[model samples]
Target: MDFFNFLAFYLYVYKFFLPKIGRVLLFREKRIGISQQGESTLEEEKSQIRHGVETLVTEALHISKGVLGDNLTQTSQWCEKKKEEIQKRNWKAINGSYISSIGERALSGRLAFLPLFPALPPQILWSTVSSKLKTLNNTSS
Candidate 1:
């Protein structure tokens, strides 16, 4: 399979296996008398997911190198560049910009009832919110 397909398959498998891994980790933690709350904290879950992704990427890179030989160098470099790009991303700034835009629209009275009413033409804010709410409802149910 191509790199995108390979990456996606690994992600799918990782997601499939993650719960089993979490169970094993929880079992070990209980045996050691740690994690007395009987649940993994959010940070611990994030750490496990991050580590799992890193491991999958590293394994994929090795397999690609074996299959592609000399051509894999470019792919490895591209992966590293993309990793750097992801690491350099400023999520807070991005969120701030989105919130500021919404605030500006609201203050200008263009989106007076943002949560209840849709914005004027050329903006699909209500549709976005509707879809998001549907997704949340589906997930919760």
Candidate 2:
């Protein structure tokens, strides 16, 4: 019975709920194209993108909290903390590169799979440490 419940939950999340959320998050048009904009204008555009990404993440995390449990909520909090650290840096210097890199990494890295496969407990632990190391390496260099 518990196994069936888990299976149903997994199927629902993977087949229906997550795909809808992904469409909202990944398909949004946040780019304004390559134009001859000044630094301040470019920075404003990047900030809007960052805020959109953050909102998407928050909504996804809320869904995960309802479906998965505290583990995902904790993981999301950790990611947000790392993001805050990056944001606290010189925005003029970082120039939205960090947010873009974070988005790329999230899509390519294990974080993308964690919510889809809650049965793989060890992967969550491994991915968390691996993600932290990658963030540190990226920030240091």
Candidate 3:
């Protein structure tokens, strides 16, 4: 698959797996469940998710910049639209993969671009994408 597909797969893995990992790991301990180590592991996983998300965002921004320039058109619209979809749909989805985004900030960040794609459900996905576009606007300003 391409880079965007890679990113989507990466994010999906972390987004779905991290929390489940944390739950299982933490609960595997004592009757009370969740040792200090388990908690720390969860935190570490969260940190990794955050880092991965940042990397994903960086790569996407780089791609958009390369393809869309400072201006957007139909030719380059998919990148920005995809960005919005990611941000909007999975602001919450990213929460579990060892890290998370506050939904409002993420949504605001992604919505910075216009002529965004129209899609169904999966709010966090859309939010992610919209946030990416927003952040790029912030950087340019």
Candidate 4:
């Protein structure tokens, strides 16, 4: 399987385990809390809570990286860098164009990202749906 797809599937699987891990950690803390019986200082309590949080985060990251492996992690980073490079090049091309007005240029940039719907103008889709609903209402009445 492709790395991205495999990574997504792995994350989906981990979603179930991640919460279970958190609940286990929280239960452990509660047990610790009961055992301490307020004997621990405020700073100590804070430290324990912080440690719990850090452990949870570390475990989550460790799980992600552990399954994906360092090479896949590096590949993901490389893909992100390439995506950024392409976006920068595209943006430069758009901004450097001869479009005189700022508003027009901005609109062109916006349209570039928009999916094409050549079959109908934007308003026509809404108007068509509304007309169909009106016709249905008339027939029902």
Candidate 5:
């Protein structure tokens, strides 16, 4: 199959079968004092996911820069300026609440939302870059 189909299958196995299997194995090992290793394994998985997402974002940004040419630099500068504005806003309480909600949902095995989380940043970046490129093209023409 193609890449996206393969990805869907992989995520299916990861989101559904893997967790169930891990729980079952951990339960069986619980009597033997081996259950503590599961926490480390989960942490490792999270780290890998974080790394994969970062790599995806980097690749997407590279592609965008190649496509947008000079406009991307201007767009990135604007994004950086907006980032400072965003950082000044008080989002601590909302951010904490959102994090806890996702955490609770993830722990409960409702991974339906998991696939969308990693895509959001790249999608937002693409839209922003594309919009800026369009505006730049219009102005130049």
Candidate 6:
């Protein structure tokens, strides 16, 4: 259980919720020369990767399960921060404000339309935060 292990499971959950995205867990190894022993090693590597992902989902809930749970519980902090910035019009002078605004509008629309879908509310909420953060990133770029 580690950061990369947690990331692997995060991606797996996303794939489960959005199956159309067609994400797969991949294990990459490069060997200059192939042998029967090497093939067996490859199979073992794949098995380990699969087990790691399964552990993350079924038992661990990410290597940082407690940390992730705490993080999720702080969702209100995020909304409060965003709501404050919106009230302040903090990005009015930023050039990427348009993209930020577009994302905000998109998120608002998504929230308005998708609350009944159970799987989409949290995704839309996080996307909104990420989209707004993208504006700050673009502004600095």
Best by TM-score: 5
For 11-85, candidate 3 gives per-residue lDDT tens digits of: 998999888988887777653455676788899999999999999999999998977764657646878888888
TM-score of 5: 0.28
lDDT of each: 0.70, 0.75, 0.69, 0.73, 0.73, 0.69
Which portions of model 3 miss their true places by more than 4 Å?
1-34, 70-141
Per-residue alpha-carbon lDDT of candidate 2 for residues 1-141, written as tens digits (9 for 90 to 100): 999999999999999999898877665533322333456688998999999999999999999778777777889999999887876675635755665566568656765666787777786678876787677556645
TM-score for each candidate, following the candidate numbering:
0.22, 0.23, 0.27, 0.24, 0.28, 0.23
Model 5 whole-model lDDT (C-alpha atoms): 0.73
The alpha-carbon RMSD values of the candidates against the true structure, listed in the order shown, are 40.0, 45.5, 43.6, 37.3, 43.3, 40.2
Which RMSD does model 6 reach against the true structure?
40.2
lDDT score, residue 14, model 4? 89
For candidate 1, lDDT tens digit of each residue in 60-93?
Answer: 9999878897667878999999887774575545
Model 2 vs truth, CA RMSD: 45.5
Candidate 4 lands at a TM-score of 0.24
Best by lDDT: 2
lDDT of 4: 0.73
Q: Where in model 1 is the C-alpha error above 4 Å?
A: 1-40, 70-141
Ranking by TM-score: 5, 3, 4, 2, 6, 1
- Considering only N, C-alpha and C atoms within 3 Å, which residue pairs clash in candidate 1? none
The TM-score of predicted model 2 comes to 0.23
Residue 126's lDDT in candidate 2: 81
